[model samples]
Target: MDHLTALENKSIFIIREAYFRFRNIAMLWSVGKDSTTLLWLVRKAFFGVVPFPVIHIDTTYKFPEMYRFRDEYAKKWGLNLIVGRNEGQVEAGMGPGKGTKLDCCNELKTNALKQIIEKNGFKALLLGIRRDEHGIRAKERVFSPRDENFKWDYENQPAELWDQYKSTAAEDNHFRVHPILHMTELDIWKYMKKENIPLTELYVSKNGKRYRSIGCAPCCSPIDSTASNVDEIIAELESTHTSERAGRAQDKEDAYTMQKLRSLGYM
Candidate 1:
């Protein structure tokens, strides 16, 4: 098999494994390229239909296009879309406007995720996170565990040698299954192009800039790029020296910001 096909097959296998292992599992869809690619893999793995619900943590600060693309695709694909949010926090003026980026993310994203997981009684969460995206995410296992409090015990991570993933989690702890953890940013763009996946228009160039990694609108910025389409994005990624999340403000807040966030159960 070719390199891309191999990656696709591996991800598909992981998805199927997670589906059969956890009775109440859901996939987190951020509506970004990586997560969207994961969504495609779900359809492929389940014969053109996604069996589990797709969760979206709405921070209420997302770009307008994100919501549009999300609504459009959920209907187009007939997805079991479940929107998660920290409604109390959002009502109390909790956002990037009132505090540090770290605080905003902790409340808006991490806490929101925790709330949904508990409320929905989800035993496992399928994430599209890749080790290549950020330094902290690199420490993740294929089947990572988080306590009921949503704290990630990175130091005591379970080993997964030779595809033998430890799917079992302790009582009150849920697993964070990362099927695409081995895939890179370039791999995602290339696969999207190869599969002709419908992506958010925000990734394409507007004027002389384009979003390399998308998040909440206030904290995310576009990089200087002329890549207007999937093929151009793949070409640009080949020679680009920039970090994928270079435009993300939360990661720049402090050196251990992401580590701390993930430890506190941040996605």
Candidate 2:
């Protein structure tokens, strides 16, 4: 099989394995390219029907277009979309401008996710994170486990050789399944194009700028690009030297900012 096909096969197998191993499970959908592509993969894996609920941590500071697209598509596709928000923090004037990037992320994104996982009692969370996205993500395992406190032990993850993954974890601990960890940004675009997946229009370049990676509106910035279509995005990635997360202000605040946030249970 070709590389793309191979990746799809591996991801399908991993999804099925996670389904069998975990009694309570859910997948996180950020409504970005990666997660949208992962949503398509879920349909493919389950024969056009997703078995589990898709979780989205709504910081309430997301781009208006993102929510519009999300609501439209969720209804169009008949998705089991579950939105989680930290009402207390949002009500108390918590936002990117009020706190540091790490603090804002922890309060709005990570803590919200943690509460959702706990409320739903999900034993596994399938994420669409890729290793190439950042340095910290590069150290993730296919079936990585996070403690009740949401600490990721990058140094002591389980082994997964020859397609055999370890899905077991202790009580109250959730396994993070990253099926597309090995895929490059180009592969994701190509797959999305081939599969005819719907995506947020904000990704398409407008006035010589397009968002390479999306997050909270205040923190995420657009990169200089003229690529308006999926094929053009693939071509741009092939020639671009800048990292995908470069436009993300949070990652630029400090060298180890992401690492620190992630260690403290930020996604």
Candidate 3:
């Protein structure tokens, strides 16, 4: 099999395993290319139907196009969409502009996700995190554990060799299953093009700029790119030395910001 096919098969297997092993599970959908590809993989795993709820952590700061795409695809794809939000913080005018980016993210994203998981009693969460995205994420295992507080213990992690992933966690702890932990940025674009996957228009270039990585409008900036289509995007990614998250402000605020955020359960 080709590389993309191999990645797809591995992801499908991991998704199936998570479904079979966990009693209560959900998939986090950030409405980005990586997560959307993960959703497609879930469909392929379950024979064209996703078997679990698709969760989105809505911070109310996301781009309007993201909200539109989320709702439109939820309807079109027949997804079991569950939207979670830190409504209290949003109502209090707490945002990236009003506070530190780390504080904003912890409140709007991490805390919101914690509340949803606790309320819904989700024992396992299938996230669309790729190891190649960031230095912090590169340390993640295929099946990572989170405490009841939703904190990731980076100091200790389980081993996964020969596709033998350890899914066991304490009764109170939850597992974060990374289905596409192995896919690179280039692989994602290529997969989307090959599969004809639908994506938010924000990814395509507008006036010679495009969002390589989608996030809240307040903290995310568009990169300089003319790659409006998938083919051009793949080519650009092949030659660019820039990080995938160069547009995200929080990551740039501190050298250890991403690590701190992930440890605090910032997904």
lDDT of 3 by residue, 145-247 (tens): 9998888999899888898888887899999999999999999999999999999999999999999999888878899999989998999999999888888
Give TM per candidate.
Answer: 0.92, 0.92, 0.93
Residue pairs with backbone atoms closer than 3 Å in model 3 (clashes): none
| Backbone Cα, N, C clashes tallied per candidate | 0, 0, 0
Q: Using alpha carbons, what is the TM-score of model 3?
A: 0.93
- Cα-lDDT of candidate 2: 0.89
Task: Candidate 3: count the clashes.
Answer: 0
| Candidate 2's TM-score | 0.92
User: Once model 2 is optimally superposed onto the true structure by TM-score, how far is the C-alpha of residue 266 displaced, in angstroms?
Assistant: 32
Q: Per-residue lDDT of 165-266 in model 2, one digit per residue for the tens? A: 987778878899998888889889988888889999889999999999998888888998999998899889999898888888446566588678989998
Name the lDDT value of residue 57 in candidate 2. Answer: 91
Worst 10 residues of 2 by lDDT: 249-258
With candidate 3 superimposed using the best TM-score fit, by how many Å does residue 99's alpha carbon deviate from the native?
A: 1.9
